[model samples]
Target chain A: MSAIYKRELNAYFTSPIAYVVYAVASFFAGLLFVATVLEGDTSDMTYLFRNMTTIIIMMIPILTMKLFSEEKNKKTEQGLLTAPVNLLQIVMGKISAAVTVYALLMVLFIIYALIISFFVTPSWVLIGSNILGLLLFGTTLIAIDTFISSLTESQVIAAILSIGAGLLLTSISMFKNMVDIDFVNDIIDSIEMMGRYENFTLGMVKFSDVIFFLSISVLFIFFTIKVLERRRWN
Target chain B: MIEVKNLVKKYGDKVAVNNVSFTVNEGEILGFLGPNGAGKSTTMNIITGYLSSTSGTVTIDGCEILDDPKGAKSKIGYLPEIPPLYQDMTVKRYLEFVYDLKRVTLPRKEHLAEVCKVTKITDVYGRVIKNLSKGYRQRVGFAQALIGNPPVIILDEPTVGLDPKQIIEMRNLIRGLGKKHTVILSSHVLSEIQAVCDRIVVINNGQLVADESTEEITTNFTGMKRIQLHIDGNDNTVLMTLRDVDGVTRVRKVMRTIDGFTEYIVESKAENDVRKAIFRAMAKVDCPIVMMRNAEVSLEDAFLRITAGETQVNRKGGR
Candidate 1:
């Protein structure tokens, strides 16, 4: 697992996707920080975290697009598949590599928050809670994108489809409000990724919400492993 | 040692490998000979545990692939048809990754050095694999397969797209490896297998057609004894005389000269020595037998005959 993780992490750096996504994502984060919080007198880190949740809808796909698709497309999966390592090890290696990069992106947000400290005193609890929520949220997004990447051999298709899935998951909160049916609204509110995250933004870190995000991540990773095994048999 | 028994692989409705069984003893080089889409790769894939077989089992060094994949896979090194390289990585890094993936217990640096030396890729070890030429990339692939010094190595068409010089080098490398490891390689090129393998297993249309030693297959195929004759006579007269000769099953004129001499190839009914009979018949017809020699069946002809569904005839003389 470590071997695959190291190789995958190196590949992310060698390929241009890592740098491109970092530049584009950091640029958007800086733009949003300056336009919304810096230009105004108040400093609500929730706005920054909310925008980040949206930013990852576009950025997480770029990070996880080539995870399995590139290996399958290039036929490099033969080497990995024939080795002594099992399928779950390979999947975890790839997921952790993406998470490592996502963690780095979140660290960069620290710099944005530190810069905000220069103008006004921001609530440290809000910043910490929101960052925790974003990390869990980004991990779930990466896991979902990783599964999507496993479904196809073309990285472009993987990226496009993952972005579409991320959009749907984030948009579930909007659907919950737009619907008039009580049962439908309750179901959507329970399943919506951002709906669960709203508690964290309100400075309440609930154990159930953390478990919800983690469960979704594992479910998707499990699905990806099943896809790989099915491919071998068929 | 590696043993595959009654292996069957199906890709949906297509049976890629049907009840294929073969074994490679220790320190032996087994050649898999077949045409394109002949189930050679599919069989190799199943044996290496890359693809699951519909039925049957592959055991390497007494460990079943499906039951104990880690044990079986650790004993074998595989090079697929395309080399399965990480093109973006430097050759050295790619090999290091393979070493870790294989979980080699040997000293890492020395094992890598030995592999590089054997494959003759030490010079380009630091270069990116994508930037190397095809031959160099192939050599790099070979280098990784040697890492950890696995006891069994499976190579699929190792010399498919190489130049003649590189092909010879690669063959020599594989031959050298045979002294220490069991090797199974697949190729459609008849001469390549003839020069490398201790035993040959021929598969055609998803079935094992022939499995014997290199010499056995060649000699069995040569059972249809043929003689090339240079007779001093008219083309049609020499052909008819040879055709009528006792033990001569068929005769065809190969070339005719303006000075009333002709060349003909005469085939016998079975594995008979038809040289003396042809000489005596030529003397009787007053047509001097200028030259006569047995036509040997090359491995190319043998492969064609076996793949063309003539297994029974070839099997008669081969054990």
Candidate 2:
């Protein structure tokens, strides 16, 4: 598992995709910081975190689209699957690699917050909680995209499907108004990732919201392993 | 070293390998001979645990592959028909990854050096696999298989895309590996099987058709032996004289005129030596026999006959 992690991390650096993702996400975050913080003349990071969440939704798919799809296209998955390692380890290794990159992007937010401190006092507690929320949200996205990558051999298809799934999960709360039933509305609000993310950005770390993200990531990782294992028989 | 029992693999309703069972002993080179889509690769994939059998079990070194995969897989090294390689990675890093994936407990430095030396990929260690030539990439794949020093090695068409020189080198490497590791190689090339294999197992249409040694498969399939003779006479007289001889089953004129004489081929029934009978018969007819030699059956003929379902009748009739 560690070997896979190291290889994946090295692959990210060797190719231009990782740098491009970092540059694009950071560029968008900086632009959002200027428009949200400077224009409003407020120290609150609520708008910044909300906009960054949308940016990361696009970034995570690019980071994960080629994770398993390239392996299958190159026939390298045969070596990986037939190795002595189990399915869970391989999946975890890949997720951790993507998470590590996501974490690196999250660290850049600290610089943005520090710059905001120059003009007005920024709430370190609120900044810390929002960072935690973004990390958890990115984890779920990465796990889901990893599963999506396994479902096909073409990276383009994986990326498009991941973006579609991410969009649906994030905007699912809007569709709740269209439904008149209370039960359906309640289900959508609970499963809506953006709704769950709103608590952390408001400087309140809800236990239920944290559990939701953790469970969703775990379920998807489990599904990814099942998909890979079922391939051997099919 | 390896045992496969009733291994059947089906992709949906299409059966790929049907009731295929074979065993390889320690320190033996078993060649798998079959044409394309003959389930050679499918069987290799199943034995190596890359694919699951529909209704079968593979036992390697006393451990079942499905039940104890890690234990069984750790004892074998496999090289598929297409070498599974990460083209972007350098040869050194690629091998390092394989060592970790295989979980070798030995000292890494010495083991890698030895594997590279054996596969002759030491020169390309620093180059990326994508930039290397096809032969180098193949050697790198071979080196990856030899990383953990597994006791059993499976190579599927190791020399498929290599030139003649590279093919010979790969054969020598495999031959050297056979001294210590039980080797299972699959190829449709007849001469490769006859040259490198200790025993040959021929598969046709997902079924085992013939299993015997290299020499035995050739001689066992010789239902009727032919003797080619050059006679200094007309074609009809020589053909009629040889046809009247006892034990001569059929006679045909060969499409060649050697030294101003017509060549007639005489086939004998039941593997009998009819040269002396034909000699006396031709002497009586005053048709002088210029030259005579026996035409032996080769492995190529045996492969064609066995795969074509013609060997059954020949097997029942001949000893």
Candidate 3:
């Protein structure tokens, strides 16, 4: 698992995707910080973190687009599958690699928060919770995006489909208002990803919300392994 | 040692491999000879644990591939038809990654250096795989297979796209590897297998047609003796005289030479030495014999005969 993780992490840095993702993510975070905190005359980062959800949702697919798709295209999956390693190890290695890249992006946000601290005092607890929320949210999306990447051999298609899936998961709660049935609305509200994240943005680290994200991530990782295993039989 | 017993692999409705079975004893080089789409790669894939057989088992050293994949896979090294290479990685880094991926316990630096030296890719070790030529990329693929020093090495058409010089080099490398490892090399080229392998298993249309030692296949299929004759006489008289020989089964004119001699191939029964009879018969007809020699039956002819459904030459288990 560590071997695959190290190779995958090195692959991200060796290619231009890592730098491109970092640049685009930092540009958006800086743009949001300047527009929301500087001009709005507010030290509260809740609005900034809240608005960054869309950016995280859109940017994660780029980070994970080539995880398995590139392997399939280049036929390197044969080597990995034939090696003396289990399917779970391969899936975890890729997930860990993408999560490391996502963690680096989050670190840039903490740097932005530190810059905000020079002038006025900001609540570190709020910043901590927001960062934690984004991390969990981003990781769950990463798992889903990685699973999507494993489904196809084309990296462009994987990225596009992953973005579509991420947007649908985050915005599915909006359909609750359109439906008249109370049970349907409650079901949509229960499963929506963004709704569970709202608690963390308000400085509440709910255990149930954390478990939701963790379990979703695990479920998607499991799906990715199953997809790979099924491909062998094909 | 590797034993593939009654291996059968099906891709949906199309049966790619049909009850194919063979084995490679320790320290032996077994050649898998087949035409295109003959289930060579599919069989190799199943044996390597990359694909599951529909209803079969591959036992490597003592572990079945499906039952103990880790144990089975650790004992074998496989090079597929196309070398699985990461284009963005340098050869050195790729080799290192394969080493780590295989969890080799050997001293890293020395083992990699030895593999590079053996495959003669030490010069391109630091270059990115994308920039290297096809031959170099192939050698890099070979280098990765040698990383763990596994006992069983399976190469699927290892010399597919190489030049003649590189093909010779690859064959020599495979021959050298056969000394320490049990090797199974697959190829469509008849002479390549005839020159390199100790035993040959011929597969055609997903069926094992012939399995025997390299020399035995030719001799077994050489049951009908063929003799070539060059006669400097009239074609009809030479043909009739050669046909009149007691042991001559058939006679056909091959070609007319520029030196006023006609070439003909005369086939005889298996136990007949019809050369003397043909000489005496031709002399009686006043047809001067220019040249006469026994036509050597090559592996190419044997392969053509076997794949054409003319012979069944399985020597395994005396069946």
lDDT of 3 by residue, A69-101 (tens): 989998899899889999999999999999998
Q: Comparing candidate 2 with candidate 3, which one achieves the higher DockQ? A: 3
Q: What is the lDDT of candidate 2?
A: 0.87
Give the TM-score of candidate 3 (chain A). Answer: 0.96
DockQ of every candidate: 0.72, 0.60, 0.65
User: What's the residue-level lDDT of B230 in candidate 2?
Assistant: 85
DockQ order, best first, reads 1, 3, 2
lDDT per residue, candidate 1, B31-67, as tens digits? 9999999999999888888899999999999999999
DockQ category of candidate 1 = medium
B-chain TM-score, candidate 3: 0.81
lDDT of 1 by residue, A1-234 (tens): 999999989988898878888998889888888887878656886776787877888999998998999889988898899898999999999999999988888877688778878987778888888888988999999999999999999999999999999999888776666768999988887778877887888888999999999999999999999999988788
TM-score to true structure, per model: 0.89, 0.88, 0.89
Best by DockQ: 1
TM-score of model 1 vs. true structure: 0.89
